[model samples]
Target: MAEKKSSALFVCLGNICRSPIAEAVFTHYVKEQNLSEKWIIDSAATADYHTGKSPDRRAIKCMKRHDIPMSHKARPIIAEDFKNFDYIFGMDENNIRDLKRLAPKNSTAKIELLGDYDPEGPCIIRDPYYDDGDEGFEEVYQQCKRCCQAFLNKVS
Candidate 1:
């Protein structure tokens, strides 16, 4: 039998910051663990604020510092994402709630807190959009890395 495709969608208020970073982090983790064949990881925003832009410079720089390449373009999460993604992870409670609201009643079960996978620290991965410097970017990157690892462990 063919292997099933287990997909995940990471979401934030604006795709330019947290969500894209989560996408790259999670995708990198899966590839590192040799689980790439079983998963299709991606990301989106609950809002369209940066719909056509690349990830925020700080986010890109953080990923580059860790040698992770991010190829996803910012986009808004649509209703059909609910059907295409097996799991929907939100960077914060607000994004989760927004995605849940757009989810088809039957697809509501797929939405979850991104931090649900990270039980030890804070549950919400803070947005670095308003940060004054690189410090917040590094913090977000570290948290995203932890969350990705936790997610891989659970799915593996």
Candidate 2:
């Protein structure tokens, strides 16, 4: 029998920072565990702001520093995403609110905050787009790494 495939979508306000990092971190973890074939992971934005753009440069640098690869372009969360993924994790409260608002009535995905899986504590993954330094991106990377690790452990 074929193995069951689980899917997850990470979401943030613009998709150029936090969400992409989360997606990459989760993907990295799955890959490291040799479970990539069993997982479908991606990232999206709650708004159309950065659609079609690559993740912010700072995010790229932060991910690279940790040896995580990120190649997803920014895209807006669509009603179809609600149907495609088994789980949908938002980076902040606003992203969750927007996702809940946009979720189709018949959608089957479970929506929640990614930070809920963080072992450190349940906290929001704030956007780092406006930050003038790399610190915010670094923090985001750390949070994503911790949450992704914990989430993977739970699902494994």
In order, candidate lDDTs are 0.86, 0.92
At residue 60, candidate 1 shows an lDDT of 89
C-alpha RMSD (angstroms) for model 2: 0.9
* lDDT (tens digit, per residue) of candidate 1 on 1-156: 998889999999989888898899999988888888899888999988888889989888888999999987899988888888989999888987788778876664488888877757798898889988988889878888888898888878
TM-score result, candidate 2:
0.97
| lDDT of each residue in 61-145, candidate 2, tens digit only | 9988988889999999989999999999998889889999999998999999999988897579888888899999999999998
Clashing pairs in 2: none
Worst 10 residues of 2 by lDDT: 121-130
Best by lDDT: 2
Which sections of candidate 1 miss by over 4 Å? none
RMSD of each: 1.2, 0.9
Question: Which residue ranges in model 2 land beyond 4 Å of their true spot?
Answer: none
